[model samples]
Target chain A: MSTTTLSKATLSHLDWLEAEAIHIMREVAGQCANPVLLFSGGKDSICMLRVAEKAFRPGRFPFPLMHIDTGHNYKEVTDFRDKRAAELGERLIVRSVEESMARGTVVLKSADESRNKHQSVTLLEAIEEFGFDACIGGARRDEEKARAKERICSFRDEFGQWDPKNQRPELWSLYNARAFKGENIRVFPISNWTEIDVWQYIEREKLELPSIYFAHTRPVVRKAGGMLPVTEITPAKPGDVVEDVLVRFRTVGDITCTAPVESAADTVAKIIEETATTTITERGATRLDDQTSEASMEQRKKEGYF
Target chain B: MSAIENIPAQGNAVDNGLLRFLTCGSVDDGKSTLIGRLLFDTKTILADTLHAIERTSQKRGMEAVDLSLLTDGLQAEREQGITIDVAYRYFTTGTRKYIIADAPGHEQYTRNMVTAASTANLAIILIDARKGVLTQTRRHSYLAHLVNIPHVVVAVNKMDLVDYSQERFEQIKADYLAFAAKLGIDDVRFIPMSALNGDMVVERGERLAWYDGPTLLDILETAPPAHTERAEKFRFPVQYVCRPQDSANPELHDYRGFMGRVESGELAAGDAVTVLPSGLETRVKAIELYGEKLPRATSEQSVTILLEDEIDISRGDMIVKTSELPNVAKQIDAMLCWLSETPLDPRRKYVVRHTTRESKAMLAGIEYRMDINTMERQPAEKLAMNDIARVSLKLAQPLFTDPYVDSRGTGAFIVIDESSNNTVGAGMIL
Candidate 1:
């Protein structure tokens, strides 16, 4: 038998996390028949894309890239999404809430209402149309209280509703990706990663993102202790005063509900420095729709929101 | 050694090492409170979370801010005021990052505790000071050891209720040591703490000056790193086969790579390896990680390896060092932790998933079920949910495996129900 003496290699926590994520991606590809990676051009999804590259490179992904377009999203994010997918030469599938609304599957209370929550209906319809067995997402457990209670391999019913009480037991690395027809599983490979970890990985990997993540001058109105971007979907109220300020988004969602924080951190290094001392979480400081108990994350998750 | 020497000065930058631990005990043993205190003292709790918990406490007609509300995120858990499943909590101090698996303390949730301990490096078993040691405490300790967690911390919580008595703490520690000795656990550390009063959890409470030892935070920071437990031999289970036949990238055509994460030990280029179940020999031609070639791939790194010789390999096949071939057998004697609601029936067939290999298996015979409380072996007919038993299984196909004591990555397997596709039990090869 031939053997070689090699020096040991020490891996950082981020390396371990990346390896675990790649393993999970491979497992999903090996197990699931029809799977799609949900990419929103956000930081988390961008990290997921990088992990997918490491998992299977020089070959096309077994699954396609998908986006649940709310139709109220920021132009920068959607443009970046298209460019990133095109650069990878992978097929991108975009299903919009507008299409669902035209079909009468989604009905908004007001014309100017945020279509973030309504994206779930469109998402479930897309899953039904595509016959996807698994939808890989970038949801982290440390993001919110409800997400923290979710399983890494969260199983969804035929209606795409989540039953947190009846989740399957995920022990060790043996995830049960079994789902009957019409039932899908939402796989979160980065469930163990935190916001800081994501940022650290981004900086280390030199991942590109939309410009809105960095500090930029933009017209915004202050409402509910958060800066709401002034856009056609969300215009200023009667007494609201809009101003230009240097701000950045801690999280990017629909332009109607997502808020920006005042920051001068322009580079990834500066953003890392800012995140280290930040006292407030990403969602608490930014998301407008999460301010009330009625629209709690748990309630939304039960309604098929990712 | 003086306690003050163990306590590092405030605001020291400790290495950002990762530590995963489980907190388990009987219900109402202050397990949740201890985790809450760790997060609160480490300054990981956000201002909004603190305010939310405070408002929830006030609405519930409580005098103090209930820290347990921070972890009990589910609505049903809040309504019942108990953790029914494992809730993972993440926090970081200047020195280290900790992942706490707050396992449910109910007796029936032993499966939950086992799930948490499966990946844990350390375990913090809470023992109520008022109650020296309970049956649940022993059960949690045994589960922790069974999973091969290297470190064990016996936290005597609710010290304030016992008047911060040193004698009481010593008595409990002595009793625990005696019990732990029977399980062959040596790295047990005892600390007296009050999860409510914040004594010796994060800070050194003034009342425990007479009892000199590192605080819970200090001990966690100084505990041994988890990577020291890797197996001594290289073990890699093939997960996927990567072959890109893109015409544009002609350099990659006909490139066959066996992709898998190194489960244990290390593999270097030119090292001879054997593909198990087929027993075919091959030498490592190259180790590629994301388009970059490396001299070696160590444990826990996912990489693609090209062999010198063409061999028949697929998913569920094992590629290990030729010198360290593991047991390839069809019959396995192992310890089983039944996890499903339905009891294990020896007459029925179940799918055994070992590493990436899946095969049909059935229980040959159950040797005995150990009573967790008394450590007694009792003859059991069927293994119920949360029951631990030593049994023999006959597999439809041979598997390459190591004993659970030798390598955790290669030794453990899960039993899945064929009809429901639910994981019904976990086994460790003896």
Candidate 2:
């Protein structure tokens, strides 16, 4: 083939996905005045950071990095988050669920209750404190059923509640990131990507991820039809079955709700290979929070959960 | 089929391009079944997801897997069991990756179809083989043509209901082509299939032997990607200016780069360019992608460009080759689609956001409003929900744009309601 034909055919799926993501990031920067990117030290957010770097480099990012800590997350991921922010020399803001609890905002029914849902409260409080008009997240539409219907630039009320039925009409590449005084827009740059696509981009970009994503022989308790990662906050009960099985985390979230799956994939290549043949979805195989009900994510999202 | 089922660990869909298309039809037309068949045949649905849907189906005492359960449950209320929003689904075949924008077709939901049609390269207008071409068919075809989708495939669904007759399929094809030609749609393909029985979707089942053409998946794999089908007129809109004056780093001083996407065409070093609205001309200094100097910048690549001459340019400015200049006008005539519940108040001023430029525009005049069902252009004073009208707009600032047909990136815009801060309308330059 001629060089022109080769160039035309060279724009692979990953290239198209990366360009679309960068375009979305730049749109948020151009439209919103004060925005912050919600970064968790997971594989998805790691890929998102690389996209942000590609979007605005040689200069600093247009927005700061913020994390709504559940206060029950793995220490390794949080440590990586801090280190990555320090290396980039960008501002990092962390507001915890503990802070919200002390402020009488987040209330738990039991002492051992999961703090994952309360992250929304801390996130909204942080948004109010920082006066941010847009909050860029690494939420993908393919992750769960509820996110599939969300727009690229999602609108939130003053209470941070999302009205799924009444979303703005996003047309062509022209995004509507405008919001009123107390309202905000949740901008998702990677909404079009899937699990394997994220893995492909990470492998192609050679991005670094948290170590917990790789397989390791870790002790875990089996519950919620998933292997719950044994942690200080949520330890195994007397009658609970515990095993030191080799596993890897598909999604790295709050330790109280995030679980690991039985896997031997220690590298990105192996993980991609495992993902292609696996019958379970990323969330279905791991996420302990989603086992409650089908409408739970939608209900929580309506109440300002990310 | 076995080869597709066993997806390879390496080199998965890297050699092929991506196809983004939308499926348009009502629930009665078996639209959901067709989408489900595509995902199922390609093995995109995992075991856990299929199991969940199977349980839901069994609970309702229905036989077999309820394929509609794959969609229609997210964000949309189940009062009518109809999906209202445009839910996007992704699946990959060995040859190409697909992004299916599942949109509903009711007169009140015209905005959803327009939103999906805007980004789609092709549209699958599903027609029930028994009912032939209905008003909904015409609406979808018209909107697809209006959005300038390059290829449209009219899938005559429910062939099993019509006993897989070639005469019925040909009759429906004839009806659709007659309607398509009226709307100036030149590139349309027809397929006969039964999504429930799995005929002609992925595999040519035993029934459709009389027809000899590419399957739906076959046609989508060869469809051109977005920018290749359009005219190559280089139009770059300057989004933001990057000036990193880090005194700590000596090499970063006095560095100013124009940050934006290459909306169309391509650019190389030493190409003479002009900054619009200022009319200042300069040469391309360098194109930087993550601090790496690139030899050329093509369409849709978001990069920073440094000009040889230090001209005063900021956001809302257009960068184009002096050879090919777009029309710089303060007054634009467009076909605008009303997307909001609030009617258009002609006396009020709205914000016209086109490319990177934002201008205050007024509803100067409404030439005619399109009745979506009847396909008639009627005189109207105001536009309500799902209304398309040819209107005259006077802008507070000049926007350099081309017709939407010729250049999608530089020609489309959105109107914002100032009081509510809502995107109320979508406009395409005429």
Candidate 3:
């Protein structure tokens, strides 16, 4: 109930990052007519939710919260997504890949194939169905090479395609979020944030996240030199040895492709320490699918994968 | 693993602050190589990434590792062996963090360079020592000044090819200084180094004993923070209006707060402010930052402001101190950089988005297009892509704005083609 005067003011990198993110969020809210925050219950999206709160706190968000469920995700993440949205009393719209498969829009090569890339079809369908003009995502520029080439407010064509070579020139903080009727813009507020920054922010803000991020004993199978989580959608293959190891997921994607690393860091502070010392990038060490092709991420992005 | 121990902790280094810089020069001036070396020397490049780059280098028929491959991440860039867009790379030394915007040096990609320079605190202009100063170097320098980058470091790269001659370095430096002086650039520094050899980039090499200057990393670590020269003036552009009517929290029933990030200066409780375009005056009751009330808020802090009296205010409204008001007008003259491939048509109506306001604007007249290479002005009827020209525009509504030379946050805007919805140009108010 008491106010304290801030003296000797010097803004830290985190403060600058937070302000920049909030500003971008506000720009999206002001420009886009039908906008939605893509919530996946990940650390980046959690930080985004916090920024949204700061940007528009005493009032409801201008748009709803939506999720494109891959149906192969961990229960912990989806549960956290629902609970967080409920607590905030915001509208959460969920569209699943299963629906796309049922509608014959997504055809997989095999039953065991990962549904990660096919989520783009479901996401596009959802965009068309709801007429979302803009989708605010938690993608970071440092996450991948293609993402680094993207503008903060990336524009998509009528078919929801990304053209890296031909992008709008984003100067200063003045982002051009204008789009045609069918065209939508994918806004990345935290594009400048590095992985270390995210963890540092998590530690500073004390944000709640899914428990799978911390080190825990979980059943897993060693495949392609990465530990693939043993979920119902991703069961162990023949002659695959399952083991219970102390591990944690640096990034959470579909269970079929997401991998975990061996670590004993169970808390946010410890995770920060681990992240600082680790030599491998989060995707390089944990993603079973990204290592297969060098241009896969870019190709998927062009097809409208967030 | 000892090398890993040598790396500084992220907590201490990042806390010192972050520096955003851009590297630009003519094509093949080793801009990517310089950035790659910085990352490599800082140990910020992961081992997996290094191995991948090495494999890629071998496949490209190179005997040694091609460090430039570390950047040039896109498939087209790998195949064409040229950087076509701006790529951002991050690294950290034990004392400071850096965000390097590696911009393409080709003349066609000048828009990309402008984009990078917009947010850069400093610029490292790389020049091949063999070719002292080319037109592209001058063009980049002009662009850097156009965006008001605080510091400019002229790095004469490929020093090994020129035998690391201090005479050549001094000659290049003198020529650059003369050119920069003409552009009114005061804070300019020069360094000679070989990005390919990792000399004078991160560590001071014995080969450069003749040249006594701080290494590139040292200079970056010691340079003063940016935007400290301008006099402080509060300019808060209302980005959104917050009014929470949730019954669960009774305290927020009648709350109406104007949300925005302070673009410059500071705002405190009880400070009298004026809303622009509307010309309504009020006093600041309190500043709220995410559920907590603060006595004051400084520049770059996103907070909600509660007014002592409720008034009709919405997005695109500027709130500033009553004594300090920006220029409010519908007709203005400015310099614009055309970004789209389509030429600028004087008869076309475009949308100009400035701060939080959007208005239909039409080009009134084309004064002249400046030749980036020679700094000569030539009368032009139409502006092609990547052309920098001085022009006059008439807006449908008055915009509260300032000259870019005074306040960058309040003076810049973008031109959008309404039909295609593509951002076609960037304009700086004169």
Candidate 4:
């Protein structure tokens, strides 16, 4: 490449966003004492992995990767998650809602209940377990109303709750990751990156992602104006017709709650093009749990959900 | 597909994924109202939040539910119906996610707006149709441009005030275009809407049938976010020096890595680079991300770099590709936007924190004051709050830098009043 080729190189907005995200990841690694990357094996987390690689590839990262499992995860995602972590030769730590429940730290009203909200208990326990001062996440502002209210370095109380009212005043690019004991900071590296940015970056970087992100023929049943996968965990109800449809997940959450959207855009490039004309916000299209009054994002963040 | 029974009840290693964004505009322009509408319409508001807005609106004797009440959370702000602090509101869409920094619209709060927009990829600039392009609008636009925010959405609000006329929208659009061109803002988008009546905001407006474009929500969801990586000049300001103190980890103990984020450009191991301020030279031996080593590091990625030689470097100094070195200087001229409540005193000295470096700056001389409304420049001796003027400054030490327009990460700095310890002004290198 020519040295003075400022405009010649094929550098898109997505590339810049990825580079910025990677930089943020490195900053977290360099600045924080005990940093752990929160990886859910979702598209956003997949994008964060690419950033982490770009930020620190030839060597191992300073911190290990962690996940707060809601016990109701998709088999495809969890299978791909373990395989990818093993392939990279990186440490992957997991804390489960099932364990939290067993320990009596998390209580449920029903045995067949959605364990999505209970993941917060496991997350706080994991934070305390590792003494993690900074937990890097792939939560995008464009995803949820409460995530939008978050600062890049969101401060959480000792109890792992987010008080939006008591956020630190972030001036310029000077981020104060400083916190007292037991109070960890949730650092969002790609906080500024939109959903489209994540997809585009994924495509441009040729990052490896799980098959669940792409469109596939799946047996699903329509419920709550969305398609819920006909899994045993969230089986088809009576009077519901299970049909095979080409669908893709805009976001990957608990298998029982995250719905799939009807899409033929199987490739990353196709997803990018489809994302360009998408009118419905990403969260609006795929989350079965988010379609209700009880599982609002703002409330989730306040209650210590990522 | 693996059967749910066959699938292990495994939660994949949790990765923290989140997003962030910023919103800007003046008070009367309905900036806060737009945020309120987004939160309200999206069903993100809780019963307590609704009750609070209702109580506040009722206290103010409003007929309808005041949506702006959701964002204007300060006592003085609610009383005066103005946003003073940067009110952050979070909401999510189905396809993706977001973080909205609702910044103050008043000219005096430009510094606060700058602080908010500094880290934002997209900026939504609200424009009141009745007022067209006001001085505050220009200042906001200029700040957006100056800060190098990749996208700008000109939400021309209060369309109902002008009877939702396309002609008025076109005129205001033209006026903004003319002014924006001077500042070199390329991706300027104009969206005309009545934030109050829900026109072209969340939903399409029937009145704007002549105009065909996606709603504000549509644009926000679809607009290309600013790209982060590409072939560009590599600029890294050392923020820390990482060397393990433990002798047991021999490899880590002697590992001397200069850590910083690539402000712009791609860098590879073995790329010849130079240290700024000292003008020393070195080549990248290795790049570290966490404990892993990388062959390359690009713009915006934060990583520690090991050099071929042990060069004298610290937190304030910068590392750049030797081929693209910035000019080093002690004296410089820049456009200053006074941000303090206290007036500017030429004799008073303050610290200028630029990039990752800080230096004591003395006011050398004032050149001219900028008339934001008329876009005119006039000679001035002193600047008060919200005043934009060209000023010459002499630094206590020579610094390596570039013009703000050329390199945003390296060219910008903020003036801190040593007495009150508040950031008094922000400046762009000229």
Candidate 5:
């Protein structure tokens, strides 16, 4: 028999990824005391929601749905977020950074600064408020450098920080979710998923998502070679020329920081096709806050940002 | 170039989706480096990660950032420029996403590879272009076949070291093809590429003009997902028991539910299922998840089921569809890959964890030790670390299982050393 013909018995790559993800999701629900699905209204989180539906559907979810609102989120996304959560009949809990700031727990460098890094403090507070032992996140390993180094059931300190150097050894499918009081585990269900996998699963599930994912004509100003969305919170500079461009957000985040990529691919199929050929990384194209090394994802995750 | 998708889109349907893959090869064959290249060239490696790799390489007095250093995390592995443990890396393309278990190639690390590829849908066995096929290659290929990874990609790496010769590539490909045929590996793809210099990896190479096929990532993105919907039986191993704590909620307080995810196949609410090891039979009354009831529970879903009759069931008990009961046996023969530094003791008893069932297993006998390089099985009295041999185990109790070749989730098990609690070896049922 031909060499090519002999390999047909092997399981395809995606089947393995799906099975593992499903297994991890079930493990979290089985082991943890109070687990909550952390939704960001992004494609990855949307994929997590679908996986959860497959994992624990036909019945109410074992845990509630939650989001750590930055108070700088896109209006379109947060609006859709409320609607989607209501439609699913699942509890949607929002712990706002604005409330944390008011309560003197979150201090900013400036009044108009991006609240991306400060999200950690608010998240830790929310975890404490709900006494959630496991916070199920949509963080994928393929997303960033720090995330790549994390365990699927990443253990967090009582302070809600991640120490990459002191992680537990995760071998085979045996994950250690053991922790003491005041400590919690940050469980990433789609840690194995890629950007393309998220989009494909999104298309497959016909999951209702925020409109920012698809390409649409919007008013924007070019800054640092990225199309910065024209928002009142993040106004354009004097020299920056505002223009109309058909663009889509590769990743959705706090509106003050998330940028858009130039594209006319208005549908999921188009997005999938466009994603295949794009050379720039997902965070590189859209997340303006991640451009610097000082405020990196690792630092944010270390400070308790999911 | 963007319109070159050739694989069927499986994840486009609600019922069909993602595939998981693993990679195995010899230590110096660039398995870790190849995975790093795939992640980097695919743009899955973030800029910050590249910067970190660059810094670490500089500290190690290397002019070029060694891609293998990204996976060789242990201090010992870094000093040796080899993989000592199974390092997992994740990435995605438009067509499919991948999670790779880059298992070490050393003889002692064979058990690590088994653990890595146990759940893998596909396996990529890297063969060095200059070295052609080595014993480690055969051993890894055999293990991949044993674990039943449905797809195998024979990536002929370091073609640059071989002058990009088509004859050399074809020769190696033919050798692999011949051996793979004997092992029942039907879906194998041979690709020629240089992992270090980026030849036919993410982009098509200018060198090797004779080759006409998709890049490694391209092939990966378009490869078909393994279809296992036709599994003969359904199994659900209970993980927990749920009963609401609130006294006010009377409807939930008395609702005793057996919680677990279906390991394989599908089961309807009224379908009859047999409890294995105990041999008791019952019918499903309702499939519940949280507070809602479902008509059915498919494989991989975490749903709690209420049986029509309250037959005794708990964790470690197998709930299999009555129509498809597996072979229940007290003793099993299997191919074992030893992992521990301490050699196997014939008199010792260890805990054998198969699926959810944990039973005491004693070493009955070692049949033979495999010479991976020569594809020879030598009769052995004892097995040492990294030795692959067929062994017989006398179990304290019967286990419900299929052959490892038939089903991975239920057919294989791990031997945990009782004293140290270390996973010493993995076995595939024969």
Candidate 6:
């Protein structure tokens, strides 16, 4: 440790976060018997892939990539998900909500009901099918209130339920990632990262994201205080005010439940600038499913939602 | 109190690295309000978040917008008006960022407080001004001290309740200082604040004319990151071994890397190192961070280390500087905080995960248990949840370790129940 090398001693905030996430990802590879990266082709998942590359790159990732698709997500995201996985040469496992519905494990309340919440069931079924001891996700604490209380290696029951009251007391970077038969651990490598941190990392790494993340012209209808993109599944009804507006998604989720905020920030650098000064939270701005109640996220999480 | 007289009126421009601190107190002490004020004054709270809490406060028929509601993250916590678990909050000043771990004080949640205090470089012990120093204040301070946090900021909150009296602030400061000294807590600072009135938190209000100390934001911003201010022995625990056998690339053919984070101290590319358990000495050939090579790496930065000579090393192995080796032992005497409701069963063999190493440990003896209120050691036959006790463990295999005070990275472990696979206790090596 010379005086000249002292300048490299303290890392920037993004480096610290990237290093931490890489550590967590390696922990999963070192500890878990069977693990899978839950990729949605979203920004957070893309960030996870970059960290996974850093953690075990030159070598293949210890686990494969899996997706629990809702069948109604943005085509750009699903297409990017497949493209990224193929380019990385990693095995990609796609388990669809439609397949779950075909198996009768997931039943829709109505023909037009959103398949957002039912992704949990399909996710659990995929875990059972693959016997994945750990599923690495990209959920961050800063996204919502209940998420802020979750552990880095969030433990779930045999039925994939999260217990909010009783969590493994995580100390230091030591993650308790042990589970029994039929049980699994959902690891959020970027649990400590904020939305702004994610964007800054994306800008630093020059990571690619789906087109919907940036501003684009889309046919959208404003309802319940959220701008829902007009898709075939969620088209504008008779009394709906449809407008071709410039918008970008704050969070990418199911088409029926996820909405986009009005934005013209098209680049990652612009997104970073916008996120730094934005007055709205990531979920509150675009997640229509979160509008029901403050505890809705908690309830969904308890039933094994990532 | 000592640093108060030395601090300038307008504080220094802290251009240091990131700082993580714990703010521990109950709801009544305005701990939430203090945190909320810090976030609000920093302009870190988004409009929708504030609006949501504002709507909730309006529903509850509160007047001043109930800033405390901002910190109530859980549904049950919001209903009961208390922090049930450790909730993380973030904000950034102009120079650096902050990560605040908000842990509860009212409940018998020593495990929660320990979780929050584990990674904190500093701890904020919030004391109600009118009440002076209470039992929980000492308990939380003891927890911070137990974790060996470098700094402690004793915030005398609710100063307005005492008519903004400097005498009241001094009395509480003296009272807390005595306990802090008894608990062997060094680097303690004090400030009088009214979180409800937004005084001496992020701002230097007009009411606190007698008090002259750096605000909480100032201290947090300027505080050095863990293992940065002092030079410590380097400890790198091997988390994973990267051996890529791809025939397509020549670089992947012979690559064998020991991947992990620099848990403490620092390491460079040409440093002499030793692999533990085998006790083999080697020199670092290179330090690979993704595609780039680093001349040196500091604590908390994950990197892949390639040795000059091929030595047998795997996960759970230790890579240390050959000059400063840690103690390797089979028996450990530790201060154990049992975190499970099932209590400790002497007949059960628990797994001790120290660093990356895992070994079976049997409870040898329970020397004594701590009584939180009395601050006394009592003889106990069995250990229960939230009980801090002196316990001896017999490990199935030897582990490379150090005293918890010397380096937290090498001296701490979590006890996992072999049957349930849950973390049963947290132990710090004596």
lDDT of 2 by residue, B113-161 (tens): 9999988988999999999999999999999888888889999999999
Per-residue lDDT over B221-258 for candidate 6, one digit per residue giving the tens place of the 0 to 100 score? 67777644767888999999999989999988889989
Q: Residue-wise lDDT of candidate 3 within B102-208, one digit each (tens)?
A: 89998889999999898888999999999999899999999999888889999999999989899999999999999899999999999999999999999888788
lDDT of 1 by residue, A148-169 (tens): 7788888998888998877778
Provide DockQ values for all models, in the order shown.
0.45, 0.62, 0.60, 0.08, 0.12, 0.48
Judged by DockQ relative to the true structure, which candidate is superior, 4 or 6?
6
Global fold similarity of model 4 (TM-score) = 0.66
Off by over 4 Å in 6: A1-9, B1-15
Order of candidate numbers by DockQ, starting with the best: 2, 3, 6, 1, 5, 4
Specify the poorest-scoring 10-residue window by lDDT in model 6 chain A: A1-10
* Candidate 1 ranges with C-alpha deviation above 4 Å: A1-10, B1-16, B227-231
Q: Of 2 and 5, which scores higher on DockQ?
A: 2
lDDT of 5 by residue, A111-180 (tens): 9888988888898899899999889999886666567667788888899988764554454465546566
Q: TM-scores of the models, in the given order?
A: 0.95, 0.97, 0.97, 0.66, 0.72, 0.96
Q: Which candidate leads in TM-score?
A: 2
- Cα lDDT tens digits, model 6, A177-228, are 9998899999999988888778867876889999999999999998767788
**lDDT per residue as tens, model 2, A1-306:** 111111434556776777788889988998899999998888888888888888888889999999999888888899999999999898999989999999999999998889999999999999999999999999999988889888999999999999888888888889989998889999999999998889877787777888889998999987656787777887888898878999999899988878889999999988887887788999899877787888888989999998
In lDDT terms, how accurate is model 3? 0.87
Q: Candidates' interface RMSDs, in order?
A: 4.6, 2.2, 2.5, 9.3, 6.8, 5.2
Over B1-430, each residue of candidate 5 has an lDDT whose tens digit, in order, gives: 2332422255332222445678887657877778778777766655556776798889879999888766655444455666655656765553454667766778766667776787677788899999998877888888887767777888999999999999999999999889888777788898999988888888776897899977887777665555353454687877655554547656655566776766666788899989866888989999865455677766555567888886777766788899888889789999887877788888889888777667899988888887766778799988887788999999998888888766666777888776655567778899
Task: State how far residue B235 of model 4 sits from its true place (Å).
Answer: 3.8
Best of the two (3, 5) by lDDT: 3
Q: Which ten residues in a row are the worst by lDDT in model 1 chain A? A: A1-10
Q: Which scores higher on TM-score, 1 or 3?
A: 3
Whole-model lDDT per candidate: 0.85, 0.87, 0.87, 0.74, 0.75, 0.87
Interface RMSD of 6: 5.2
Flag the better candidate by DockQ, 2 or 4: 2
Candidate 5 at residue A140, lDDT? 83
What digit string (tens of lDDT, one per residue) describes model 3 on residues A1-306? 111223213466677778889999999998889999999999999999988887888788888999999898899999999999999889999999999999999999999899999988999999999999999999998888988899899999887899988988898898888888888999999999988889878877788999999999999987766787787777788898999999999999798888999999999988887877788998899888788799989989998888
